[model samples]
Target: MIIAVGSQSKIKVTAVKNALCQLGVKADIEAVKAHSAIAEQPFNQETRQGAINRALHTAQLVPRAAFTLAIESGLYWRMDAWLDIALVVARFPDGTCVEVESEAIVFPSSAVEEVQRRGVHTWTAGQVLQEWGQVQSHNDPHLSLVGKSRADFIQDAVVKLFQTLQARHLLSV
Candidate 1:
């Protein structure tokens, strides 16, 4: 079986591979750079659509892929504070899809505000945090804040997505 992942990020690719391995799935994994077409700091619905777009976009790029997967992380405003979550969307060849999210973590409102204030389309929440010495960089952010690697969140989300699809009998692979 061939699985295509819509991301060039090593963390995401490895997380998906790790999740599939934990599920006892053996297949060829492909990673492609696909745009999410959402805001640099996606929130709410943008997060969901970003994941879906990545999955469909990757599937379009890799026609022979048995399954296509993509992961998107964004913040949600709830109870006065912003919560960050990772949303993973997986698509089957027939255009069927399932989605799952990682546990939400607290995101500093200051960072969100800074990004919003900058009004730059290229700025991300992570980058804002990085500038303020919150994290090392835009790549592996969870480590400093949550003490968990971003890969951990993505891996868990992928597993949840896989299990959800399996429970619904939506995944044949």
Candidate 2:
């Protein structure tokens, strides 16, 4: 299967490929440069909108791909906590469409308050991690603890997340 992800970020591409591998699916994965104003703040409409925008944009760019995926992670605040939820919008060559969603990882109140106190508000998950001290120990400050790379401490968390998604059949059509 050809899985074309609509992002040039190597971290995201690796994560998606690894997630697919764990699901026992062999796919030819590649990254494409697609731009979209994806709202980082979690809301159903914004989440779906971002995914759709990217999927369509990338599909237009890669007309020959069998499958394309535009995945975005949005963070929503709920009761003094932040929830990290993933949204994926997929399209097949024949115009078959599927939308798969992942549950939220609730961040502690302390983390949320610290973020707001810093006056650093951004929808990007990488930015949120930097606002906190999560990247302090890493040599590469931009690397996400919850993203691609095996040495990341958050690998287990990510793996468990994808497995959960698979178990729920979120990856299936």
Candidate 3:
């Protein structure tokens, strides 16, 4: 199976490979830059549209592939703070589509505001957290607060998301 990954970011490439490995999927995967944009604010529609845009673009570029994978993520204030939510959209050759979404624990608002204030155009959840000086806060009570690095958190979430997708039979190798 040939799978076209919609982005060329290191984190996304690693996440996709790790997800495929964990799911026992055997396929040839390649990364192609489908869109040129960064996250500014969080919204459900924007996230979905980003993924859809990438998926459609990649599909045009890699027409022979079994399916195209697109991932769009953003941080939103849920409950009281920003939470990382990534939604994956898959487009098959026959025009069918499937979507999967994964979310992390809410992030503190101070962190989000600080990052936004810095005018940083390219920042991930991990970078945003680091800017807030919470990298070493071992006592902060939150979900998955066992000193888990942001990278690890995203990896776990992607793996779980792959599981969720497979259970739904969205894609198969």
Q: Largest TM-score belongs to which candidate? A: 1
Model 1 residue 70 lDDT score: 89
Candidate 1 displacement at residue 15 in angstroms: 0.1
Candidate 2 stretches with Cα past 4 Å from truth are 40-44, 77-80, 108-129, 132-173
lDDT of 3 by residue, 2-114 (tens): 98989887767777888888778888888999972545444547677778888889999999988888877766556766676777777888877787766466666676676
Please write out the lDDT profile of model 2 over residues 37-123, one tens digit for every residue: 753343546667777778777888888777677776655665666665566667767766576555455544465455455543353
Off by over 4 Å in 3: 36-44, 115-129, 136-146, 168-170
Off by over 4 Å in 1: none
lDDT of each: 0.86, 0.59, 0.69
Error (Å) of candidate 3 at residue 2 is 0.7
Question: Which residue pairs clash in candidate 2?
Answer: none
TM-score: which is higher, 1 or 3?
1
Q: Encode model 1's per-residue lDDT on 61-89: one tens digit a residue.
A: 99999889989998888788988899988
TM-score of 3: 0.73
Clash count per candidate: 0, 0, 0
